[model samples]
Target: MASKNRKPPRVGDQPGFRRALIAAVLVVTAIFIVAPLVVIGVQAFSQGWAVYATAIADPDTLHAILLTVTTALIAVPINTAFGVAAAWAITKFDFWGRRFLLVVIEIPFSISPIVAGVAYLFVYGLQGLFGPALQSADIKILFALPGIVLASMFVTAPFVARELIPLMQAQGRDLEEAATSLGASGWRTFFSVTLPNIRWALLYGVVLCNARVMGEFGAVSVVSGNIRGQTNTLPLHIELLYHDYQTAGAFAAASILAVLAVVTLVAKVLLERRGAGRGGRPTLAANQTVPETTT
Candidate 1:
């Protein structure tokens, strides 16, 4: 008798088991990430826009929104610049203490935001170590706009750098050298070569940084003094509304932030997909073909 042969197992051979396991994991993860957002949305629309209108109508809430957007607009750019510079320094060049410097960049992430706030207070608050000097020069930091911006910058600084370092390292310096050899100036090479390579990572980092800056509460709360219409940010304003027994108003404000977060997440996914498509496409020239430069 001839020996019988058996077919190789396909991925779907164990379909029922695999499907059950995947379903369980997906359901759990979805609940973990989305349950709170659903609750907030339900609360926001439960009263048929009356609560949302009331929340938005409040002058204090309006001021907080303005302050939050303004601070994020200012701080995100500063952090992006810093992140790019830091990534360049760490990846493109070798230097003494470079390892130590990279470690220092992560300090803000490890330290509690409350601790960061308190540390800033020690340096900039009235009666702080630098208080006399600032007062003498008529400069204010604690309980002021500068303090809010500074705290936000500190918290969000690492996001871009962390995203860029690995990307820059993996990309290497080949394109940059090729551009330089082809009569491109250093600035031109950077803009034409380096920027395009890391643009997606940079944009993703900015989105995350902006989200964190907008949602930050502990650190900003400590320094902001929660002064209504003046120092209050959207997150702080939400807290105030919650404390004032305005549950619907609190959820309404929070729902706006949740919506923004969702929008940012969607944009990030689309951009990442675009980046992936670009990355997957073959370059016009393997040696040194100048591709169409993107602005």
Candidate 2:
């Protein structure tokens, strides 16, 4: 009885209510997160390994996968370039309408992708302003691969740019000025200094943007017309299969996307851990201060 009295309360102790609360939260997360993942994995292979392989290997499925990959490959690089250039201009050299440009860049995150899709359709469709000229020139923007790419670009336009804005702002222009003072060319300074400093943040944005580009449904759907083995992306193809009552095939196709999401999550975790180990976020320059780190 004396020893029990001297002992401190542990998680399993009678008075340890916090532990129980934590356990409940964790259980809730697992139910919503882990359980769904398990379901997708199981259903993906419900028809056995051989059938799952066939589902994934189907010609339409393969085409969808290729188009998705192509979209990301094109969109990611284009966005990366734009993000860097925008971040540089906004942070390094302030001009008229800087804040306004920032607001414009963030519009994508605030609005629904569906709205973006509809807006693009109106702008690029056969009845749009440029539609007549494009058709006269034998150019097809809507209901084709080019439309898919453009829609992706529209929705993912903001990611990398936004990620680098705060980072570059915090970094200030000290390094760039120093490099210039030392007679470094603009191109050299940018390649040698700015790129290295914001590499991680840039990568973080790119990974996220690419993930969205590959997974985009609504915008791509509006432009792609869901043509089987042609404009159909992975998400659309999955829907096509599901609509045809091919549950197994649909789930199998979905598994690839699920795996990609998991991989992206893991990469984000690694980047976070790496940043932490390196003392985390950089100090905001004297001109500006970084926001307080949040969980």
lDDT of 1 at 5: 25
Residues 94-164 of candidate 1 have per-residue lDDT tens digits of 66776567667766777789998998898888767898899889997878789999999887767777777
Root-mean-square deviation of every model: 7.7, 5.4
Write one digit per residue (lDDT tens) for candidate 2, span 97-215: 77667767767766677888888778888777788788899998888888899999988887787778777877889999999999999999999998898888888888888889989
Global lDDT scores for all candidate models: 0.81, 0.83
Identify the leading candidate in terms of lDDT: 2
Give Cα distance to truth, residue 126, candidate 2, Å.
Answer: 1.3
The TM-score obtained by model 1 is: 0.85
Q: After superposing candidate 2, which stretches have Cα over 4 Å from the reference? A: 1-15, 276-295
